[model samples]
Target: MRPEAEPAMKPVFAKIGKPVAAKFRPDPFQLASLEAIRDADCLVMAPTGSGKTWIAEEAIRSVFQKGGRCWYASPLKALTNAKWVEFGNHFDPANVGIVTGDTKENTDAPIIVGTTEILRNQLYDAMHSGENLNCDLVILDEAHFLGDLDRGVVWEEIMIYLP
Candidate 1:
């Protein structure tokens, strides 16, 4: 039998010249979304790797500037944990807190991060106890997950019950 054909070798590119440092600037779309969020509810849709998270960070900054509280919800616990650490870095560890089924810390902090399911449960508790959610801004990351058949209802309930 003839020997099997050798696989083609892929080309490797050499490192280019020194990388240039570019000044940071916000995209117009990000600016527009931030403005809209200040006046009313806004839904931002963008591809992955886009600066969507920056919009959330700016919004949170505005609320904190006014001495207001914020709640950031993500569809996954891992995302929540990551954001908890990130926002902690941005706003200082003393101001940021996180609550997941596996972990809970500084529950009374001004900036709270947790899974959307936890937020929905908090809403249920608030309704039953007749207490208002003391939050000025609610940032739901990966909001498209609201269409998930299994957990979509929780997100829907949060939208309906959140003030």
Candidate 2:
């Protein structure tokens, strides 16, 4: 049997020589919301810049840390591009990828940022082609689009047919 690789050590001290750590200083509502969505899918309905992205970050981090892949889907190409840049900063670029109607990079990456239709099409392809599994968790970031007249079908397809 092949042996496992050794884990890399995280720097105990920051560049300034102080201990590096995460501070749990989220606001009351943020804390409550984080706790509420820790284990299940959430329907966050908050104003923009109210830290809704933080919840998505936490969920993505949780999945990635567990040695699993996360597929974050958006309704708009602009949002997909924005999320690609945002998540690329957090995860390694090689491990992070983007896919949309016009953009596709690192399609096999662990963390994928894509439009809902792109993901749906990928899922459909995977099923029809019988490819190996690729994703573990999928976060529909702007999930309220199920009410939209033009694009709701794509999101519904993803939610209904994802493996």
RMSD of every candidate to native, in Å, equals 5.6, 12.6
Report RMSD for candidate 2: 12.6
Q: Give the TM-score of each candidate.
A: 0.89, 0.75
Q: Give the Cα lDDT of each candidate.
A: 0.91, 0.81
Q: What is the lDDT of candidate 1?
A: 0.91
Residue-wise C-alpha lDDT for candidate 2, range 1-163, written one tens digit per residue: 9864454423422334756798866667776766776666556788878888887887778778999898899988998999998888988788889999998899888899998888888888888898834877788878889888998888888877875
Q: How much lDDT does candidate 2 score? A: 0.81
Name every residue pair that clashes in candidate 1.
none
Worst 10 residues of 1 by lDDT: 5-14
- After superposition, the stretches of candidate 2 with alpha carbons farther than 4 Å from their true spots are 1-24, 32-38, 130-133
Q: Which candidate is the best by lDDT?
A: 1
Clash-forming residue pairs, model 2: none
